[model samples]
Target chain A: MKILIADDSRVMRQIVIRTLRQAGYDDHDIVEAEDGAEALAKVGSESPDLILSDWNMPNMTGIECLEALRAQGSSVPFGFVTSEGSAEMREKAANAGALFLIAKPFTEDTFKEHLDGVIA
Target chain B: MSTTDTGQRRRGSDSRPVITDLMDEDTILAVAGDAWISLVGEDEVLVPIPGEMPGDVLSSWVDVVGPWTGSVVLTTGRATAEALSRALLRESAPEVLDDEDVEDAFGEIANVVGGSIKAALPGPSGLSLPQVGHSPLVRNPADVCRVEVLWRGEPLTISVQGALPPLPVTH
Candidate 1:
């Protein structure tokens, strides 16, 4: 599966890639974008199988990106990897049609557990 | 010496345990490792300050208000700031990073760390944006509650203020 990882932090993007590899997704193609706008452009060209995005960013936030994609009728699997996982945020993400929400300080095991149900 | 003896020796001399004991060791280690890895990957090192640090290093200071109250400042040295800009651009570390670029990087780091720490804490806490400072020195002592501890070998500082009452305080 091709996955697009979007986040503003280079460290964070590397960590997510590391986690995904550790979670047995070694064969999966992983693309990266620094912010939402870049992510949208990548989405248009690459058409990834899944998207893992951060909530807060400089140009465009994850929610806005997701909404934009959905508005354009794209239905690729989507999830969030964010620091704040409040119920309100979760509800908003769900309302926006996100499949999962993974909070920060996550581990390979946790990512597997969350992604297994969706990807499997 | 045995492992127990070494552990005891390490834990005994350490007076402050709020950050060390309260949070799991692996979590802290991961954070430190990630931070160091990020900085090093960009070819930046924690260098010692030379004579007369720059004035525009730290632009602002914000109090971490919640169960714990302390101040977090954002500052950057000449080399460090330059390194940060190059890292952000995914380019090689520049010989010199512009002052504005350094300030932006400092603020961004503070924001990332502060948000991560706040999320790790037990309860909800309020975080302020990074404040830019002209002077490299942190002027207000009262704002700084606690310094980061040296866990394992790396330095980790955490400061807290008084707990908030059950109800919100009306100004």
Candidate 2:
């Protein structure tokens, strides 16, 4: 499976990738995008199976990317790994067609809980 | 006689609520403690006791703009910042870390902590990209919510301070 990870922080992107491995999802191919705009473009170029994105990013935000994808008629599975996980943001994400939101400072266990069926 | 047509007493433009009014020290501590455990390490604990920061301190922060407009500043010694960078990098940490690596890693911590704090406050707010350098100045003493804690026996302080200077006190 190809998974696209979008985040402005190089360190955070590393952490998310590491945690995915720790959650025992190491077999999937990983694609990296530094911002939502890149992630949006890569969604077409890379054709990733799933997208894990940060909510706050430069240029287009993760939500904006998702909205664009939906507008373009792409039905890609998407989730958020972001610092902001307020109820309002969560609702906004859900309304935007996001699968789930895993707030930052997450553990491998948190990843497992969320990614169980989604990854397989 | 100067009141607007609506007739309600016009609140001064400077009447914006401070950080303290939105959230207290205990709430900030809880948020920081959870962030430390999740980001720093599983067993890492943040002691609530206050510690004196070293003279050569570094700060990482993210700005929160909305109902409350300010920055969530995390301050600690340079050595501690490096240590934290190493910790975040873990096995991936290089033999020697440069300034950029520390800045990125340290700023991320503030981002996570600040994000959580932003959620706790009244929202529809926007969070800026994380920044690392000297901390932002405290615009209003009454608008600050600061907490000092010891992490691995190192001193660190988190300050949620407003960016705008205090409104002039009306006579």
Candidate 3:
């Protein structure tokens, strides 16, 4: 399966990629996008099995990107990885059709617990 | 030239009193653990330097205004900043980092750590966005409180001036 990871910080993107690889997803194709706009553009061209996105970005937010995709009738699995994981934010993401929300400062275990069922 | 101007100058000079009341090294270490564990990739151990300033590496300056009036500045050697970036990015240490990139990375680190600290403080206090300075020397007044701590043996200088509510007052 192919996975898309989107975040503004290159460091964070690297961390996510590393965590995903460590979680035994080494066989899947992994792609990256720097911001939400780029992510949406990529989605238009190269549809992936799932998307892991950061909430905060320059051009558009991850939530905004999700909404845009859903509005266009695309239903690929989606999730958020962000710094602030307030309850309200989770509800908003869920309402917007996001499958899960992962807070920052997370470890590989945390990622697996939240994402394993969804992806596997 | 005027009394008001002189008073302003004096206040500025006395803004951040040399922080003699040091933060408990253990407490700061715990906070670092909470904030940097994932980013750092392993358990962090603190190393103590008997007489070194924290800002000796990753040097940058930012003015903290509003409830507090003074600057929160961090200075470090160039090599140290690169090392930190590599650790955070989980990549091999780069040969060098541009001045602006170093400042941006350092500023973001300060913002994240400082914001966490402020949230844990007793009352409301606001943290402004961080500013960066490349100069090795920082011109903070003698009175400012400078807390020097080592993160995994890397010197991290945290200086603060003016006490405000631990949380921001929404008025």
Which model scores highest in lDDT? 2
Mark the 10 consecutive residues where model 1 chain B has the least summed lDDT. Answer: B151-160
- Model 3's A-chain: what TM-score? 0.96
| Residue B106 accuracy (lDDT) in model 3 | 62
Candidate 2 Cα outliers beyond 4 Å, as residue runs: B1-7, B10-14
Interface DockQ per candidate: 0.15, 0.81, 0.27
Estimate how well candidate 3 is docked, as a DockQ score. Answer: 0.27
Candidate 2 per-residue lDDT over residues B2-94, each given as its tens digit? 534563555655368988889999998999888887777888888888988889999999999998999999999999999988888888889
Point out where model 3 deviates above 4 Å: B1-31, B46-51, B54-77, B98-147, B158-171
Candidate 3 C-alpha lDDT tens digits along A1-117: 888999876667777888887777778888899899999999988888999998867789899999999999999999998754656567889999999988766788888898888
- Each prediction's whole-model lDDT (CA): 0.61, 0.92, 0.65
TM-scores of the candidates are 0.57, 0.93, 0.67
Q: Write the per-residue lDDT of candidate 2 for residues A39-107, one digit (tens) a residue.
A: 999999999999999998989899999999999999999999999999999999999999999998798
For all the models shown, what interface RMSD does each have? 5.0, 0.9, 3.8
Model 3 fnat? 0.23
Q: What lDDT tens digits, residue by residue, belong to model 1 across residues B1-171? A: 334445555554343223333445345334434443443343333322223434433333334555454444434454545554466545433466666555555555554445555555544556654555552333333323333333222232323322322233334
